[model samples]
Target: MKKLAAGNWKMNGLAAHLSEAEALAGAHAQPGCEVLICPPATLIARMAQTLGDAPIALGGQDCHSADSGAHTGDVSAVMLKDAGASYVILGHSERRTDHKETDAAVRVKTEAAWRSNLTAIVCIGETLAEREDGKTLDVVGTQMKGALPDGCTAENVVVAYEPVWAIGTGKVPTMEQIAEVHDFMRTELTARFGDAAAGIRLLYGGSVKPDNADEIFAVSNVDGALVGGASLKADDFGGIIGALERA
Candidate 1:
C-alpha cells in the first residue's frame, strides 16, 4: 500500500502563501508515498492549479454536509470538489472539541464526501487524562464507531489517530504505544467491516516531524501520517515524505 503524507494547514495560509504550494510541487515528492496539502478554502483552487501535473494533491480542511443549503459561511463537499480537492478531512479532534461537532454530524459529512466522490480522512483520538487513565483505545474505538458512516470502503475512507495531548505540543507516543493503538484499531475495523477494513489506510497524527517520522512510520499498522506544524514548510514536509519513503 502507498503511504499518505497529508498536511493539514488548518486555518492558516493566504493568497501569498500559495507560493509554498508552488515550492512543494516543484520539489521532488517521495516515490512511495502520496503527498496532499489541505490549505484554507480560499487557496484550494489556486493551489490546485499551481500543483497541476505535480505529484502533490489538494485537500480540504472541512466541508458542510448539505450539498447546497442556507448555512451561512459554510462550504459543501461539492464546492470543495469543484475547487479541485480530492480529499476532505472530517471529525478532527480540534473540530470536535472547539466546534462541538458530534459523531452523527461527522457521519453526515462523511456521506457528503462520498456523494461528492472525495476521500474522507476521519480522525479519532483521546485526551491526556484519558490516556493517563488507560482509556485511549476505548475512547478512540468509540469515536471511530460513532463517526464512521455505513457503506464506506477502503478506497474512499481513511482513519487518522491524533492524540489530542500531542498535537501542537511537541509530544509523541512511543513506538510501542503507537503500534498498540494502531494494531487495536486494525482489529476493530476488521471486525466491523471485514476484508475491506484490512485494506483501509491508518495514519498517525499529532506532532509528527521529520526527525521522528521514520520511526513512527515503521510501526505496525501505521500506513501514513497526518501532519500539522511541520507541514507549514516545504522542506519540513518534504523531509517527512522522504522519511516515509525510506521506511
Candidate 2:
C-alpha cells in the first residue's frame, strides 16, 4: 500500500498561504508516497488551481453530514466535493470539542463523505484525562466502533490517531506508546472488517514535525502521518513528506 503524508492546515491558511501550498506542490511533483493537503475550505478551490497537474491532492478540514439543507454556516460533503476536495477530515479533536461532535455524528458525516465520492479521514484519539486514566485503547476503540461506517475500504477511509494532549503542545508520546495504539487499532479493525482492514491506512497525528517524522514512520503499522503545525510551511511539510518517502 502507498503511504500517505496528510497535512491538516486546520483553521489556518488564507489566500496569502496559498504560496506555501504551491511551493509544496512544485517541490514534490512526483513524491514516492501519496501527498495530501487539507487547507481551510475557503482555499480548496484556489489551492486546487495552484496545484493543477501536481501529484498532491486537496482536501477539506470538515463538512456537514447533510448534502444540502438550511444548516447555516455549514458546508456539506457534496459542497466540499464540488469545491475540488477529494477528502475531508471528520471528528477532529477541535471539532469534537468546539462543536460537541459525537462519534455517531462523525459516522454519519463519514457516510455523507462517501455519498459525495469523497474519502473520509476519520480522526479518533483519547483526551489527556482519558490517557491519564489508562483508557486510551478503550476510548479510541469505542470511538472507532461508532465513528466509522460499515463498508469502509482503503479507497474511501483513513484513520488518524491524534493524542489530544500532544497536538500543538510539542509533546510526543514515546515510540512505544504510539506503536501500542496503532497496533491495537489495526487489530481492532481487522477483527471488525477482516481482509479489508489491512489496506486501511493508519496515520499518527499530533506534534508530527519533520524532526521526528522519520522515527514515527518507522514504527510498526504506521502507514503515515496526519501533520498539524508543521504542515503550514512548505519547507516543514516537505521535510516530513521526504521522511515518509524514505519510510
Q: Which candidate should be chosen as best, given TM-score against the real structure?
A: 2
Q: Write the per-residue lDDT of candidate 1 for residues 175-236, one digit (tens) a residue.
A: 99999999999999998998888789999999999999989989999989999988889899
Each model's lDDT: 0.91, 0.94
Residues 145-212, model 2: lDDT tens digits? 99999998899999999999999999999999999999999999999999999999999999999899
**Candidate 2 at residue 180, lDDT?**
99
Colliding pairs, model 1? none
Error at 232, model 1, angstroms: 1.0
Q: Which regions in candidate 1 have their CA more than 4 angstroms from the true location?
A: none
Per-prediction tally of clashes: 0, 0
Clashes of 1: 0
